[model samples]
Target: MTKEITIDDLKMYRALVETGSVLGKNTVLNIISHAGEAAETILRKQNAIDTLDRIITQQCQAALDATGLHHLIDEDGDGDWSAVWEGLQELADQKRHAERNADTYQKLYEQRAESLEQAERERDEWRGKYDESETARIFGEAQQERVRALHSPEPARYYGTDLNPNRQHDCAGCGEGWAWPCGTIRALDGDPNAAV
Candidate 1:
C-alpha cells in the first residue's frame, strides 16, 4: 500500500525538475517537467473546488440543524438542495399549524368573553328586579298602615320616616305620606333649626 501524492507534492517535484542542471537528456527532462506542471495545476484547481464544496455543505447542514430538520438530510449525506427545500417545507408547515391553533384559541377566547358579558348583564337585570320588588314591599306595608289608620275611630296619622327604631324623629319635610328619604336630607340641611 502507498500514500497518494497531492498537488503540492507534484508542484514541488516540477520545481526541482525545472531548476536542476544535472540532467543530461534535456528533451526528456523538459517532457517530465511539463507533464508534472500540468498535473499540478489541474489537481490544485480541483482541490480548491472540493474544499469550497465542503465549506458550503457545512454551512447548509448547520442551518438545517438549527431548524431541527436534520432528518431531512439525504441518505448519502451529500449537500443536496432538494433536502434543504424539504426542510424549509417542514418549517413552513409548522408555521401554518401554529397560526391555525392561534386563530382557534382567539375565537374561543372571544366566545368565552361574550358569554361572561352576557351572564353579567343577566345577573345585573335580576338584581335590579329584586331591588324593585323589595322597594314595592316596603311601600305596600306603609300603604296598608295608612289604610288601617283611616278606618280606625281613634286614628294615628302616618308620619314619613324610616322604620328604624333608634331614629324616632319623623321627616317633617315629606309630611304624612309614603315617601323615601329623598328630599329630607336636603330640606334638613337647608333649615339650620330642623333636627336631622
Candidate 2:
C-alpha cells in the first residue's frame, strides 16, 4: 500500500515555499506542483483500492458457500468471479429483451385488432348501403307497375240477362275485321275469313 498524503504535508510544503528566498521561490513552487501531481495520483489509486475493498467485503459477507471462498473464486485458486457476474448480467439482459418483445407483440396485436374491426365496420356500412339501394330499386319497380295498371284499359265485360251486342265483334275496338265498325259486311267480302 502506498503512503497517504495529508493536509500536514501541504502545510509543510507551503511553509517551505514562503520561507524560501526570491531566487529559490520558483524551484520551491515547481517542487510543490510536482507534489500536488503525486497527491492526485495517490488519491486516484486510493479510491480504486477503497472500491475494491468494499466489493470484497460485501462478497465475503454475502457468500453463498459455507467456506466464503467458493463463491468469490474458482477451483483453480484464481480471482475469477467474472463468470458468475457475467451470467447474472446476461440473465438480466435476457429478461429485459423478453419484456420488450412482449410489449412489441402486444402492440402489434392491438393494431391488427383495430384494423380488423375497422374493416368489419366498413363492410357492414357497405352492406347497409347496398340493402338500401336494393329496397329503393324494388320500390321503384312497384311504382312503375302501379302506373301501368292505372293507364291500361280493362277488358270489356257484360253481365248475364243483358246480351252483349258487341260479343260477336271480337275485334271491335280496332276495326281490323271486314265486318267491323257495324258488322254489316258479309263473309264474302274482301276478307273471307273475317268472322273466324
Candidate 3:
C-alpha cells in the first residue's frame, strides 16, 4: 500500500501516527518504510525523550533501547518540539524579559564580586608601587578610578572627553547583561530535524 502512497501522504501519515500532529508536513512522506510496529517503538521513545530533562534523557537513552525514547527527547516533528512549542517559547520569553527588566540582584552580585576581586588586585598593585600609607592616601585622594577599575570598566571605557584612563574598558551592559548575560551559559535544547 505504501508503495502506491505518495511521499506527502506518507509524511502526513507518519506525523499523524508518530505525534498525532499535522506538523512537519515536509517529512510526512519520508516514513513509508516506518509504517509498522518498528515505527511505533521509535516514535514512542522519541516522545518520551522529548518530554524528559537532560539527565533523564541521557539515563533513559543509556538504559532504554534506541527504538524507545530516542525519537522523543530529541525529536522535532518538523525539526522542533512541536508538541511543546508554546511552553518552550513562553520559557524563553520569560527568561529574556526577566533578565532585562526584573530584579537582577543575583547577576549584579556576581559582577560585584568580580569587581571586588579586581579592586583587590589593583589595591595590591598600588601597595607594590608605593607604601601602604601612600597607597591609602592616593586611593583616598580619588576613589573614582579605583571604583571603576575594580567594579568593572576594566577592559576599557571612555566616560567623557576624558581622552582615556590608562585602563578603560567596554561596559558590561554592552553585551546585554551588566556583567554576565545568560548566553554566557546555554541550556540544552534539542531539535529532531537536525542532521545526523
Candidate 4:
C-alpha cells in the first residue's frame, strides 16, 4: 500500500540508521535507502519549481521591456500587468491618431500630384495650340506675299525693231523675252508645264 512520508520522517529514519539503533540491520538499511530516495525526489521537484518561477519572471520582464512599459513594473521587480494594460491603451490611441494623420497627408499628396499633372497637361495643350496658330500665321503671310508678287505691276520697257527685233515682247518684270504670259505668272497660276 502507498503512504505519504514527510521530510521529518525521512530525517528521523536517517538519524536512527546513523546512531546504530536496535532495529534489524536490513530494516534500517531499507529505511535509510527510502529516505535518500525521498530527499532526491524532493530536491528535483524544488529545482523544477525554481526553474519554472525564474522562467516566468524573465518572461514578464521581457514583456514589460518590449512594450516600453517597464515603468509599470512594481517595486518588487514584478510586473503590474494592469498598469501595463493602461499604457498599451494609450500607445494604441497614439498609433491610431498617427495613422489617421498619415492617411490624410497621403490623400493631400495624391491630390496635389494630380493637380500638378492636370496643370501640366493643360499647359501642354495650350502650347500645342499656340504653336499651330503661329505656324498658320507664318504660312498665311507667305501666301499673301506670293499673291502680291503675282499681281504686282511691272515697269514698261521699249524695244525698237532695228535695235532688238527678237526681244520685242520681253517681260519687263524678269527681263525674259517671253510673250504676254510669263513663266513666273503661269507657274503662280497653277500651270504644271510652266517653268518656274
Candidate ordering by lDDT (highest first): 4, 1, 2, 3
Candidate 2 ranges with C-alpha deviation above 4 Å: 1-37, 47-87, 96-136, 148-158, 164-196
Model 4 per-residue lDDT tens digits across residues 1-196: 3677776876786677677776766797786687778889999999999999999888767657657887767678766797776666777888899999999999999999999999999999999999999999999879967764654334334565565554446555565455446676676667898784
- Cα-lDDT of candidate 2: 0.63
User: Which ten residues in a row are the worst by lDDT in model 3?
Assistant: 180-189
The CA lDDT of each predicted structure is 0.66, 0.63, 0.53, 0.74
Q: Tens digit of lDDT per residue, candidate 2, span 1-196?
A: 3876577865776676678734377786787689889978999999999999899867644442433346567554456556555655666788899999999999999999999999999999999999999999999878756543333222334422265545433333333332232222322234565465
Cα TM-score per model: 0.36, 0.35, 0.17, 0.41
What are the per-residue Cα lDDT tens digits for candidate 3 across 51-133?
A: 77676656444433422333444443222234344445566787898878656877788899999999999998987878977
| Candidate with more favorable, higher TM-score: 2 or 4 | 4
Lowest lDDT sum, 10 consecutive residues, model 2, at 178-187
lDDT of 2 at 113: 100
Per-candidate total of colliding backbone pairs: 0, 0, 21, 0
Give the per-residue Cα lDDT of candidate 3 at 183. Answer: 20
lDDT of 1 at 119: 100
Error of 2 at 48 (Å): 5.9
Among residues 3 or more apart in sequence or in different chains, the pairs in candidate 2 whose N, CA or C atoms overlap within 3 Å are: none
TM-score of 1: 0.36
Global CA lDDT computed for model 4: 0.74
lDDT of 4 at 94: 85
